[model samples]
Target: MQTIVIAGGGVAGLELATRLGRDLGRRNKARIVLVDSAPTHFWKPLLHSVAAGTIDPSHYHVDLARQAIDNHFEFLCGEVVDIDRAGRTLKIRARLPHALGHESVLRYDRLVLSFGSVTNFFGVPGAETHCLSLDGVEQAEAFRRRFLRLCAATSGGAPRVNIVIVGAGPTGVELAADLRHTVDTLVRYRLNSLESPCQVRITIIERGPRLLPTLAPALSEAAARKLRELGIEIRTNTAVSAVTAEHVTTADGEVFPAAIAVWAAGVQGPAINTRLGIALNRNKQVLVDEQLRAVDDPFIHAMGDCSAMQVSDSTAMVPPSAQAARQQAIFLHRLLAGIERAAIPVFRYRDQGTLVSLGEYGAVGMLRQVIGDRYLNVQGAMAKAAYRVGYERYVMANLGPVRMFAQMLVRWARSRWLMPVKWH
Candidate 1:
């Protein structure tokens, strides 16, 4: 049987593993193995909620080992250290200590790299040491703990809790909004006081001229307005020069004293990807052909944030978004299922629109191709509902009906009991 090994259990890797397990593994046509550093899986987009303490991570996370057994695949818990393209083997470091010391070489007929990206600090001094990043589960939990400690220490006083969020992209904006909701909930529970209006201040600093610069101008303006309504201050066309323990300095000679700072400004390809000696773009993303195969190695394929795929002649490369990753996974799955490489279809990215949620009250975005040449410009509750539905559909499509329904029930149960009525 053809042995297929997938590295990373993020969105694309997990979806591909499930598909292959059900189709190939069950039929004994191939052996599918999924390797990841983490023992469980959580949607990356929900990291904001996890950070803000709005959602419990336990309810959302799925054990990789359990999932593999149910889905008919083998799950290996390890961190991939190196790749030998010539031998089609992966050098993985087992998680155990001295008892399970050293590495294990896993050979594969086909290898899929979906290792994902890491937070890009851009070599700014003190930035990595002081700034909190919401890239993974641990980082999010750290932010949550820090926030709670700050709130507890300032109890019975109107404290000026300053939160500085770097980067005005979707993730940064969403986290800022969620934090506002979290603070509001805290005040409602009498954990903090909002009697002094705007006491809990949030500043979103973006290097670009406008927020959500990746989207259309109108959408950016709408998002900015929604954020302002939620009491989030936006600082555009501003660059953070450095970060200290208590303040973030800007290029314009301004220092913002922050009780907590979060860095969501940029991302870079995994470090291991660079060691593979493959062609990479400026962002360090692996350069892949139309079929998502590395130019130098057809046996190796990459998807998600690690792979840079060209979408248009003018556009240099596709943005590393969850949508793009999901689309790539589907394309790769089809290519692997077919025997004739020549007959395999090329990857085509469909512009399905973008959504930026602004707290619970609303969202702002352009629904592309929803009504022909003119996009549907949306804001407020309807827009927020639409955005949530889109995410739910994506999750359901990947996890299938049964798992999706079960997850929904689990969420409902958690909301009813486990979740705190109010969080600071």
Candidate 2:
């Protein structure tokens, strides 16, 4: 029997592992193995909510070991240090906890590379050390702690708390709105005894001309208007030169100091890709062909944020997104399902629109592909409902519809009955 090893536990890797584990491993035709640095999985899109205390990660973290057992696969907790393509073996440096239980090298018949991406500080001075980011649970929880401490310190005498978010992309925009909502909710609950009201100000600085620049101009305008209505500041065409514990200096010699800084500027593939000797794009992402195989190596397959793929017979390229990852996972799974890789069909990417949640202020989305080149924009309640369902659908993929719906109801009840935002 052949062996398949997937390295990553993000959306693409996890889904593929679960399906292949059951489909291939159950029949005893092949063995499926999932290797990840962490023992659990969390949706990258919700990191902002976690940072803002809008949601608890407990509801989203999926245990890889438990899934592996139930799905008939093996789970390894370690980091892939080196890959000997010719030898068909990988050097996995186990984490401290896994060192006692796992081996250092794993053999594989086929390899799938989906390690995912990381935060790109853009070589900005002090940006990495000074600013907070929402890259993982630890980072998000760190931001939340800083946020709580800032609130506690400034509840009365600090006048106001200023938070500077660099980047007007979805993460930055959504974080701003979530923070605004968190402050209001905290005030309403009267948790801080430092006066009747505490103000928390959010300022999003964008080098681009507007927020959500990749989206339609109309949607961008709507998002900007909604954010402004919430008293969140928007600074367009502003480039940050440096960051310090006290301030962020721009190219124009202007400095915004005395603010909590968050660097959501952009993302690039993990630096380890360069060491892999694989063909990579400018962003350090592995460049894959239509079949989702690395351009330079046929045996290596890549997906998720760390990979960029060009579709066959079309000028379109698949962007790194949750939807694209899901499509890629399904496509890859089908190719490996009782079919030879050489006879696998070409993978085609479908644009499945985009939905952005604006905390409690509302939401905005664009329906594309299904509507052709032109898109129909939806906002407010309708967009919010769509955004809510988008997550539910991802949950359905992992937890199944029945359990996902039940979890949704539990979350809804918790939000309504317990508290809208968590303080700790």
Cα lDDT tens digits for candidate 1, 284-330: 87889888988888888999988888885657577788888888888
Per-residue lDDT of candidate 2, residues 1-424 (tens digit): 8989998999999999988987898888889999998889999899999999999998778888998997888998888888988888898977656364455889998899988888889999999899988888999999998888878877455667779999998899999889888888778887664343336778899998989977889999999998888888899999999999989899999888645899998888987789888899888999998778899888889989899877666765677788899999998998877563566488878777888889888999787746457777889999899888888888888777787888888888887887778786
lDDT of 1 at 249: 96
Q: Which stretches of candidate 2 lie over 4 Å from their true place?
A: 96-103, 193-198, 311-317, 338-344, 369-373
For candidate 2, the 10 contiguous residues with the lowest summed lDDT are 190-199
Q: Estimate each model's TM-score.
A: 0.93, 0.94
Evaluate residue 259 in candidate 1 and report its C-alpha lDDT on the 0 to 100 scale: 93
In model 1, pairs of residues that clash are none
Query: How far does residue 202 in candidate 2 sit from its true spot (Å)?
Result: 0.8
